[model samples]
Target: MPAIVGIAQVVSVGSSGVFHIGDVFTINPISTAKTFAGAGSFITGRGISVYNESSLTYTVDDEVMDQGINFNL
Candidate 1:
């Protein structure tokens, strides 16, 4: 069974862009750029937009892993 072990909130610096459920984003270094999850980049968690806010902020679920990687989801 899958459960939410952790939660994260990301804020957009330049443009909030479009985000959807299951959209993954990087957490480390804390970036607001909209970079796709499996796009040869480090991923921290999966996006979980619950409400429609205008502050350019998003909620994500932390990914479970034994070790962190530099790229890839």
Candidate 2:
């Protein structure tokens, strides 16, 4: 299980398409790409679909530490 530490406003370079509850995500700050979290990826948080409004933007419940770590989704 993952801890919900805080809320975050994540946005991709462009439209992120539709997001659903429990969707895994990671942030690529360099490219500003908010893509799905995968093996060995640093998991940022899970999706809260109700707040997903635009294709490029969405909200999430953060689970990573301030220092960051690799967590697979």
**Off by more than 4 A, model 1:** 1-5, 13-16, 23-73
Task: State in Å the error of residue 66, model 2.
Answer: 37
Residue-by-residue lDDT tens digits, candidate 2, 14-68: 4534433353576433222346543434535676234334444334749573433
Candidate that would win on lDDT: 2
By summed lDDT, which 10 consecutive residues of candidate 2 come out lowest? Answer: 48-57
After superposition on all C-alphas, the RMSD of every candidate to the true structure, in Å, is 18.3, 18.2
